[model samples]
Target: MSLANKPNRKLIATLAALLFAGSAAAFNLDSNVPITVNADNARLDDGKGIATYTGDVVMTQGETELTADRVVLYRDETGLQRIEASGQPAHYRQAATEGQGKTDAKALNITYSAPESLLTFEKEAVIEQNGNLFRGDIIHYDSVQRVVTAEGAANDNNGSGRVEMVIQPRSRQNTQDPDGSSQGQ
Candidate 1:
């Protein structure tokens, strides 16, 4: 089934699994649902592909959501980039993405690189992939591109300035061996 319909608590489980499959070993993260964004006065620059949301701004992607006083997102010749978020009680959330088809995750500050497909969660970053969840000061996720490296970052809680993330496992051994490890046919 498509990630949007994985029947998991973490809506992003399917998408995260599909996106992070190749980098599962490198990241070793859990399934972090999605996030939602809310902004008071939002200004969109379609030509530049930039969206500036200010005044009690809130952004949610997959299971992770963030609430800040102001948020500025801009894209230029370089690529998609985001500025820092400011707020008293910056909020975040995450959820499961797979495993037993259940998900529950959350996050706070989220910085992402659109072109590179890299995202980072810091300051009270929490993650829930499959049936497991972990909370840290920071979480980072890099989405590898066919020609570019995944250079991105983010933050969830109210930590100093760290990043973190959760990922889903999509790889499987060809067969189970007698030694306990999987053996390929």
Candidate 2:
């Protein structure tokens, strides 16, 4: 939809929820914030309950944001069903709950299915949160169950064919000793 004039609030709200819900520590109020989308071009087919935005597309709700070269949104009678975004590397970011900092992700393609509460990243997928990192050819996050699965490239001789993760150690300053003083202190 040319949302330049009449924006679809329902669609936007549904999208905001689906996008941010994947983050386990997403800011609680993000879903209640108004969403804004900007793109060079947009096409909406109400009959199919589909909308497509091309060029540099940026969507934001509160501290959560997504940017890509193209984005497609699909909805059914119930609500938004799925979202697909593609770019050289589509990017997503959202504030984490309280002091956890932010979660950031990037991939060549990203897809989210509302009913399944699943978020998938494909092609050079990478996600970083709280200084921890996960990288693979594909990654899936189950928001409801708070589980993550990743797959590396196939046994192609040219590729490493292994998923990679870097889990940073918790800072000593945040850990308390048995005596109730900070570990570092």
Which predicted model would earn the best lDDT?
2
Worst 10-residue lDDT window, candidate 2: 12-21
lDDT of 1 by residue, 71-180 (tens): 76775766445544645535433322322222232345656555445655554555443323445555555545311112123433344343223342334322323332
Give a tens-digit lDDT track for model 2, residues 8-53.
4454334333333335532222256666779999999999999999
Global fold similarity of model 2 (TM-score): 0.75
RMSD of 2: 13.2
At residue 155, candidate 2 shows an lDDT of 66
lDDT of each: 0.46, 0.72
Question: TM-score, each model?
Answer: 0.42, 0.75
